[model samples]
Target chain A: MKDERTVPARTATQVKIADAAIRVIAQRGFDVVSVRSVAQQSGLSAGTVQYHYRTRQDLLLAALERSVARQAERIRTVGRVESYRESMALTLRELLPLDGVRYEDAAVWVSYGAAAATRDWLAGPYWSGMRLFHDGVRETLERARADGRLREGLTPETAAPLVTALVNGLTLDHLNAPARVRVEVEAALDRGLRLILRD
Target chain B: MKDERTVPARTATQVKIADAAIRVIAQRGFDVVSVRSVAQQSGLSAGTVQYHYRTRQDLLLAALERSVARQAERIRTVGRVESYRESMALTLRELLPLDGVRYEDAAVWVSYGAAAATRDWLAGPYWSGMRLFHDGVRETLERARADGRLREGLTPETAAPLVTALVNGLTLDHLNAPARVRVEVEAALDRGLRLILRD
Candidate 1:
């Protein structure tokens, strides 16, 4: 009976732990991060972290959910732009690891995504988020096509995956080799957009 | 001294440990994997793994080097292919998680790559390997351009990054969503080739 009353409180604590876990994981990575680290980061006890997430894997799963949710929120918040180019450019720019926190988040997400590939249980939400992001990009391409802003012979269904891939790949490059040749990434994006956009 | 004769043997043993580490890390992730797991995979004692690599991080780094070396070998082999389309197709195809072993390797590399993003010590070889791959693609594009097979305006430098990004992103999408949409990633490649190829 008392467990019922504690449910809401427990859920709140779980959320806190998840959020803290994300930050800690993002900074130190899943490999080096410990339950104590997450607890310390969140200003909670190790017992509380254990109470919410029985194992390190469980904590990672919760952290992944929180991370994906934040990314989805960011995607949703991208307001309507005047042009297709503007919309894509804005959305993609936001997705890039242009800053410290975003870079850490991207890094952590990539790690989790890799783990998800082998483990079916971990793969579900990460894969779904990827699909949703792909779909959203496709919808944007479709809107551009309907507006006659895109070139002829291009379909959103076909182009969406390609565009998403380009953005993602470029993001990885940007993170991997920013000092040496990141400007090329921007140029590549421009060229890709030129290929699809109406002359 | 007797230590001089043991140097070669020690180096050989370290190589074996490194090779085994890749297999273990690929099966389990960098986080879940331990020195003992690597030692077990290598058929060596845990003491041997520790003797070669002082910590789990060191073993992970060694495994990363082995992964890079294998990928570099794959790239070098592909360089022998004559046709541009054939070479590009081969390279992109290899990047896909088409098989269990390759999938595991990709998963492990991606996880390590993500971790490397935050830690400077882990960044070197990973970034170098990426750059090497990028350079190889750029050289391929350059050859195509010299043969007058590519479009007039597009240079290798301009097209290489975009093509690289597109292929990488497509591979990621395929990995994440194998069931829902049969995204013909090759379509993106075809379109990209067409955009850059002369009529």
Candidate 2:
């Protein structure tokens, strides 16, 4: 039988490279980040990084996949909350840049998003990630409406987009103005929840 | 001394450089753009571009200043509308990425914003642009409340953040998922307008 050592070792190396790429891209953005930088960060050779990922775009795509997977896993693990307001608030607050890791993730995602705008090849996964996020919001709202936890006249079809926008907009605001405008974000979140949740 | 011609020529050259830098940065982002690229795009010598702007960050700052000035000028020129609803719609629409030029500006602003998160030197102008955008939204909401155009329970302080978040979130959604979810954005905009506007 052929040696199985190469397979596990290669997989571990790929994960290390991807993690290092995430940190480097988070700090410098996709456009400025180089393969050599990833290698430096990962403590691997440039040749090794290239061996695992064919191009820089490939590496970024892997990273994007990893991020979306993490988000999906979070949603899955968190599952559903008892109340509509708590569910939406919990999902949004989890996604926001409330801590260092999420903040770095937000920064990296924004950079990827900007690059995706110009590069059509990168749009597919990026767009899919956004759709998944929106769909989750819509699903949560629909469940709440079905359970009679949300107010009348506000279907998931109507409320989902608003909630998605509110969460995303508040996240962007927080990322841009972390110090002075955080309270404003919290207030908006509270008001948004109050507006939709049934008494 | 030199000549009276120097001042006008300098001003004209500065305008050319700023316009070129905006185009380049908007296309490739601030970190990826360079003085030589700006010079080539502007049809100026590298020395001339270098002579006018000391560094890429300086060039980006000047371009950012021009963008903010132009946005402020647009709001000024648009002046006050007959009603608060019209004014808010007008301002919010301007922020959207519906057209090509505005899309480019929005994209570039986002890219610069990512950079500004880490680079302290760019933070001041970045935050100021954000403030200008926020203040415009706030003032419009305040005017609406003053004129009894908005619902009784919503004050400017409360409505401003919500409105801002809604518009920004919709714009981001429109950019990210133009094909699949553009209609959702329009619906959200309408719902948001209805939430604040008087019957």
Candidate 3:
């Protein structure tokens, strides 16, 4: 799960181009994310963007790759919270679109995920991200159990997918109804965790 | 929820065109859904298709309207069940892609949902379908409460959004990982319901 083309940006130019792809996808949606538009967004020549990305698919992959890595890295570096609820609140909130950066990442994920329904090559990276995220949630739940923060009869193996699904669902709702859901996202996250942990 | 441009197909030709749009969106994704392609899929001329639905947006709306109306009508006509679990099981399962027609609706909803992230006009029907679906689940939960099937302290207001989120999440996951998640969608739905109802 961790090793599926999870490479970070290899150069400053590549990172810029990838960011440009994300901006294009976030602002105009993925259908308009061409090399020229990305290059224009990044204030670089189409030749330069093409040289780095090689194709439109490559550009999208880089954007997805960078977004996943950033979230994973953020979660990896977080300090532990006191209780299971705060722990979940921190970890799951990372998965939601609380800020602009995460919002764009989610936009890329949701938009591309919708398109990936009929596009196989586009789904590979998303699956990797999904697995990596599921593993991360499972690990967090395991820690809660070890730290005596878990409820009896609840296991990490069972709870991990539910947490991820709730997070996924919340994110989807947020994307479709940002104005209403944006405020409710954290509250919704906490509410779902309450049902999961019964805390 | 039911009145947001929720018009069903007004003619046989339009219904044919709407079904073709569904086939195109289901088979090839919404990005490639056009009047010409839908016309070809329906074995009709572009001019005839245009005469019915004028533009690609109009054609897509017709497809969405038909899909949403079909699901809504099906759920509205369901017979009563024994328990909340059975009631939710039946209603929520109706939202899933268990068969061909529902699969196409799920495909259209998922793909266009992703695209609607950036397309304002595209999201209108989705919001309506979402509201209608939410109201349906809320009503089911209300029935469960009246029948004395709901667990203590769980209200319809609190559980409705969560239930809808679980259904939404399962649909999103199935869209991305059909081979693995298809078999699990029902089981997952049941598990989520158990968490909510303790039944």
Candidate 4:
């Protein structure tokens, strides 16, 4: 019989290991991410870390999965009082490296993305997560179009990729220019959204 | 006196070494780019490559310089027949991985960008090249605005970053999804530009 406590404890330890991998990747380059480093970062023995994630690739994949889930969750629940446009702005902002946690997420994302470029196996999850994000943008745009808020001649099919690209580009820019004003980025996003979505 | 012929030969050999480094980075992940691999790719001895490059950092910086210079040159000469909008499109296209050579350029670019994200020394060239690209986009948009071809309420200052971001994002996405249709991406780019620029 499985102990009830074991499930929760195992999950908690896995999450800790994943978070530690993200931190290591964020601080060091992706090449530096290994079982030893993650173990040290998590304050657990190497054996314990390996038991959960046998290889660096396993740890990286876990971190990416968690990051994608957390990001998707942020956009899943549209606030009761928030307009679609406002909700979108908030969702896109969640993808940006505006805060420390987000910056770490962005850093690890870039590293993982680079690694995924040459590694075929990692490409599946990388593209899937991106497709999901792009789909979310399309759904939002379609909803706005249905409500007659979207500008004429602008289809969600065509606009969603641009939005996806913009968020990614902005994330990369923000990573290098950490001191860049949040208002400026938000203004860019607002202006971009406004161009597509009528006031 | 030193042989005058040696000068041209040495320069050609250095260029070959640099090109090989770019090819190595493009084919393999950035982590795999070593002095020896670059030498092997160049069809030169390790000693000969090392004599010129000295270190991997030196080789990387040289490759980046060459790539940036090549890209800048592509945008430097805007033909008289090309409209500002057309010229802008051409300039931006230079940044895309549209063809084999450009794909190589883009691959090396992604690898360098990922490395730069973690390395402070790399951050300088990374940001500088980006700033240069951003400035070019801004200049093109400003020219369009001056000609009254820009949409109402859209300033070059406001739109240039979006264009820059789109190109970067598209580049990263294309690196992963190489099979993505060229027309689809071009359509997205066109739609994006049309949103900001008057028809």
Q: Candidate 3: which pairs clash? A: none
Candidate 2 interface RMSD to the true structure: 2.2
| lDDT tens digits, residue span A1-199, model 4 | 7533212113878878877877887788788889899899999999988887777677778888877776777667635334666777777877776676677787766666677878987888888888888888899899888888777778888878888888887777667763654447777776777777775
Model 4 spans with C-alpha error above 4 angstroms: A1-10, A77-82, A181-183, B1-10, B77-82, B181-183
Q: Which residue pairs clash in candidate 4? A: none
Candidate structures ordered by TM-score, highest first: 3, 4, 2, 1
Cα deviation of B56, candidate 2, in Å? 0.8
Scored by Cα lDDT, where does model 2 land? 0.70
* Local accuracy of candidate 1 as per-residue lDDT tens digits, B1-199: 4433212113778778877877766666666557789889989999877876877777877777766666666656755466676667766655555566455556555766676766887788678767777788889888898888766567888877777777666656565556544346556666655555543
Q: How close is candidate 1 to the true structure, as a TM-score?
A: 0.82
How well does candidate 2 reproduce the true complex, by DockQ? 0.50
Model 2: residues with Cα > 4 Å off, grouped in runs: A1-13, A44-47, A149-154, A178-180, A196-199, B1-12, B79-81, B179-187
The per-prediction CA RMSD against the true structure, in angstroms, equals: 4.1, 4.3, 3.9, 4.0
Please give each candidate's TM-score: 0.82, 0.85, 0.91, 0.90
Chain A TM-scores, candidates in order: 0.81, 0.83, 0.89, 0.88
- Second chain alone, TM-score for each candidate: 0.78, 0.82, 0.89, 0.87
Q: Please compute DockQ, using alpha carbons, for every candidate against the native two-chain complex.
A: 0.53, 0.50, 0.62, 0.63
Clashes counted in candidate 2 amount to 0
